[model samples]
Target: MNLWRRLSGRSRALALTSAGVLVAGGLVTLPVTAAQAATQCSVDYVTNDWPGGFTANLTIKNLGDPLSSWTLGFTFPNSGQKVVNGWSAIWSQSGQNVTAKNESYNGSLASGASTSIGFNGSWTSSNPKPTQFTLNGTVCNGGTPPTTAPPTTAPPTTAPPTTAPPTTAPPTSPPPGQKVDNPYAGAKGYVNPEWKAKAEGEPGGSRVSNNPTAVWLDRIAAINGTPNSSSNGSMGLRDHLDAALAQGAGYIQIVIYNLPGRDCAALASNGELGPNDLNRYKAEYIDPIAAIQGDAKYRNLRIINIIEIDSLPNLVTNTSGQAGGTAMCDTVKANGAYVNGVGYALAKLGALGNVYNYVDAAHHGWIGWDTNLVPTIQIIKQAATASGSTVRNVHGFIVNTANYSALTEPYIKITDQVNGQTVRQSKWIDWNQYVDELTFAQAFRQQAISNGFDSGIGMLIDTSRNGWGGTARPTGPGATTSVDTYVNGGRIDRRIHAGNWCNQSGAGLGERPRANPATGIDAYVWVKPPGESDGSSKEIPNNEGKGFDRMCDPTYTGNGRNGNSMSGALPNAPISGAWFSAQFQELMRNAYPPLS
Candidate 1:
């Protein structure tokens, strides 16, 4: 039972009109007229623009009476500008007019409270700001009515000189590793030169070669370079950190893998340590890594450690008595190795002031259901509190790591229905509450906070191989014949089943790594380092302790987790963690947003 499947600010001040009384210093005087007192609000719109596209982040503040729900309406200055997609709200458009309605969870608005919403849009010719906005059918900017004619195109005050706008001002490096809200914010991501060289070696690879990727410390030997080791090459942990300093990078991402009995549900990633190697894992593995990271020399670097992929989720989905439980998972769970290992790792690595530890939360496909969701969070909480580590020791959680779940399914949603049947009833969705990773991650963050994690905690989604773009991507909703037809036809995740997790064919490079791409999301990361194979396509022996899992074999029939479907893995791939040229080429070829 490998649940393997599993997984801008701008301020514009509108002139106050006769409808509302104004005081000096941009404050509104109390006791306004009845009309003005009804629905006073303000909207702050900010945009991060690229050549032909941009992401708009808007913060709407309720300045008047509290409301149970709200609708935000605005218009684009040019007809060429269109809302491609949005999140945190139900977005709709008609010609130049656009509207966003609050989602169920975010509908309540206490007076003076604010909520954030945004969209990614495209533009031609010129992009201009909307001068007027309305909330709940009432004018928002001090009750100014919607203008009948298009406003003049004064150059957007927020637009950047180049296509890609700067996201944050040069951060004053936090005083020698003092913790910050987001390590990636305003910081340059360290690019692995070895990966860059490999990517650049491929034709058309230069397009994405420079993007930042994570460095995996999969084995203890990897902490210090071992001769001829393919994973880290000659670059050990210190070497990579030294190289990052040479490149003047502000931050570096390192995957803290290699717990005893790792990937108990899957064989491809089995670790060198046996099920009872807890003492060795701590003394030989974690202690050394923590010592290195805590060194004063590396304190200025924001070291992000992605702690253990495919570990904890096993306790929920693949443990004893579960539907698809595995013997190995049962043994590991019963012995408490997985929990103790993760907790020990978190406790040790988290003690470093400069290090940001993000425990791995398997993707939505693995634990998105009601039964699996809360238990998975509880296990994470248990681990966070174990071994003297508090919830504060864990800075955040990462989802979709080294897996291919689509970041968002733009064409279809969980709320959609076809022929009177909800999309969740379709074979593709299978009644999962979440239709994609973005929704699940946002929901999971809120759930984690409710479960006693810090409210300030954020989430990271690995966008490494989930683009699901290219000619196969659906342009719109599918035919309304049946729920299955609608979901299958329109869904962007092209896996044979939601449970399939391997070197998937037709996968593509997803959104490029960037900071604070959405609300509650810290960044869209390339944590998996795109070209590495998930596992060998066939039985290949190795000293690294990686066994051949059938899920990585193209010919192998499905397991209970994948509903007995074809593995959907590519052929002739190398062993796990090795570079697969064919897979890399295919990923680049089918990239969504099409690798421009």
Candidate 2:
């Protein structure tokens, strides 16, 4: 994982006002008082839609008189379109009509002021944009009210739909050499020649050597290629891009990992910059990479950038006053470097039309709990909005990077019950909502949209090391004796605990990278190149800025994260990012869909 870690170094809306408008035999007055009438308003309705659902973001500008509050109104062209969940406003739908009332924090709409709000919605027959809108009771965009008023009955208050809508084909891919909805679709993934060579050197490695793996630009040196570096060899950013073009590859995946005070929660992957070195991160690391990526020579290639891994999540789970909190995480959080650095990277790289930025979201074991999930989403939102980056700059998100979370737990589910108890009550689940990477990624995407991300955002799951295959893989559900017995027996992930993230024994290569494998998943990516060490099993000195994390040691017991259990890491592993032949051999042997 260190090679992957440092490859170089390795690593809502609207206001409404209304003038008095008469329609449908009723006044249908504006929500504002007579003194304040929003005579002019504009509703910027934008949506990212798939087959049966979509995410709609609406920006309402009060172009007329100021108002104390506003109520934005619209009608779904297709009656089937419905708001499932929303944020930054009080969203309610009645028949074909939708209304969003400003929340307490954004109720004030001075003339010319604007606010944004959005929702995750579902559509059955067809999804079409609402052509007309109303602020308060006044028609927006200078249009007159419809002859028929929308249903006035209050919408029934209910929880968001828990089940996903029916899967429909995603919209058509964009034209060639342009940004497509799924970069992996109809694209040849850039296979890192260096990694391919290493795999070819291994016993029976040629079988999967050609599969694509990400090129890690883990440090400043990694940008130009780290000569004499232990793992990466001398291939830098341009070298890889040139190779991809030579290979006629359609897309290349690059991990933009170095952040000021990176990986604050763990010692194993600590980065080169200090907590306050954000300016240096911008000028030195990000600016140079952005310059190279913006090169017209690579314009035809879809460059996927996996933004900083393990940074933002620490702000939620590992900051002081939280469970599993760390002093390093607290410092990083207080300095506001991680959020700002990620935002800056996103803005800089994302400005290039060819670059698709996927920010790293930690695995389910770390932030799947209710206590951790929402806050993590909020922090990510904060970062996405910081440093001049908007949600549009973010192409999507990636999960399970450089980790071993199973892609899917077929035998065990959160709803499974044994005897009289549910799986959530089991030791393995620990009341977490998700049991696998796919569920967490999909759920997180929807939650992100509800929190105001672009609705079209897709999710990528790194399946490099999650395949818990071979004979150890569970064949079916466990016996019905007890919850723990059921979950533990049938689980595919053979780690001592979900918190065991270092180089673990029995881990294997997961599904081969593929595009649109699941509903909302853009691709199954090998972001964390397999065979790379997660961290040293013992303290072996190195200048990579990495440290000895006890969790990587097979003999070390766990921390609060793993419930104080034994570390499940394999013995005698090398330091983070260095290649390990034993780990590669194990991965091939245990590959879920077993290597051919």
Candidate 3:
């Protein structure tokens, strides 16, 4: 996703007469009729040149009626302009000329609509200013016509400085290969039906591969993948579960991070449960979750409810208040969702039979950044354990390292606590590692050994949207950095090994679990579901085309497609839907492995 700026070297000359003359190598004239004069637009220029010359950016705002298209003209400042290149649009300039023309690839801009064009240029000196500027025969920035005074040209004696030609950027890193970091590498396709039946027949059934079986697992879980939320009110939930059950999913993790009234850290509306009205949050979310887990086909899919702790203010309020004890007390009096005591409420959640409550041991928790340390983990664990409900499989909680080094730091402390302390599963779920996946399998295996955990330890990936952008780990528990760690650095990290399908648009098979006994990672689970909108788009371009859209769209890249909709067109254009299903199957193959 690197944006490259290309520049072309050329100069523009304008001659004022009854007919406007634009001279590049050949003479092109525009008749100065009312139509041409009225259609004129203005260009405002800003240049970003550092130790090197600047890249001129022109904001072309049309002053005339909406036209099918536009052709702009601008003279480089100090004759120091070049048409390197542009994108999302195109640019062309006469040889050695800075004057350029642009055309929209898709459609025309409406009246008053603006478009931006930029070109790379090398200035003779630092921070050079333009001697003159114009757009479409009209002087830019309301400047007087160039005809009134001839443009000042560069001195004839000044010779051009010779510099090394620019080099092309390093090619993008290839999509991760199989055996990337796990033994379960590159297995694609859905669960085998025979295995699924055997798994279902087993008492309590299990998604864990047993007896060299391939049929007992869903392709989605194997790939650490998700299905697109259809237009159905259930949004393909029924079909999704069917697909999942086909894979012999004995345990499934569902997240209700966006329900209304989720007052984690006492942040108001931080929970996206969609309003506390009538406690409908529970009815709408909790009930459905219970049904999924309780279903006979998926009864084996133990339900682990992964909940986001707080919204912005809830996180901020809790952190700030806790940081300032008295301040927190006062804030709580006014707006504490846990006014009744978080410890008690957490205990109640632990008591829920069908729901294995998992809390985030992150930023606002004991091992959070700028908040508390592992002490908070100790506190929450104490409270949840003390709740005294022997809810079966009240399994362990997971930490959201968000893949950033800072967030990942706490795993060491938890690991230390678990290894050092006489902790019980009922008390704190035995620090069995709830943090997200790593960028490579080696790191994952290393942590497993170093942390004294085995393959049974719960290692979940919060690939809420796609896998960690190949290898770029998040900077904090929630901050994303775009530096592709895989490309910039050699080898993938544990997060990638854990199956964080963070990037769905990039071409490749979905991530498969590596079968390295050295890295004792247990289940590679998808903490993030597909089809769930990531809530960023348009105003947030990078955030757009995420979720199922990225993986399902075929035009984006890759040779395969997901599947076609009723319209007979690809569901999400550019990215392939076929790729998604294929990758999903690949992940399932890795996670559920054909037990031979």
Q: After superposition, how far is residue 110 of candidate 3 from its true place, in Å?
A: 57
Candidates ranked, most accurate by TM-score first:
2, 1, 3
lDDT of 3 by residue, 2-41 (tens): 0122121222222333344443334544444343333345
Residue-level lDDT tens digits of model 1 in 414-466: 89977778888887788899989999999999999899888888899999999
Residue 156 deviation, candidate 2, in Å? 84
User: For residues 21-104, what per-residue lDDT tens digits would candidate 2 score against the true structure?
Assistant: 432212345443322332577766544455565556566777777889999888887879898755567789999999988776
Instruction: Give the least accurate 10-residue stretch of model 1, judged by summed lDDT.
Output: 1-10
Better of 2 and 3 by TM-score: 2
TM-score of 1: 0.71
lDDT of 3: 0.33
What's the alpha carbon RMSD for model 2?
17.6
- Candidate 1 ranges beyond 4 A from true positions: 1-175
Per-prediction RMSD in angstroms?
Answer: 22.2, 17.6, 27.9
Clashing pairs in 1: 6-366
Each prediction's number of clashing residue pairs: 1, 17, 92
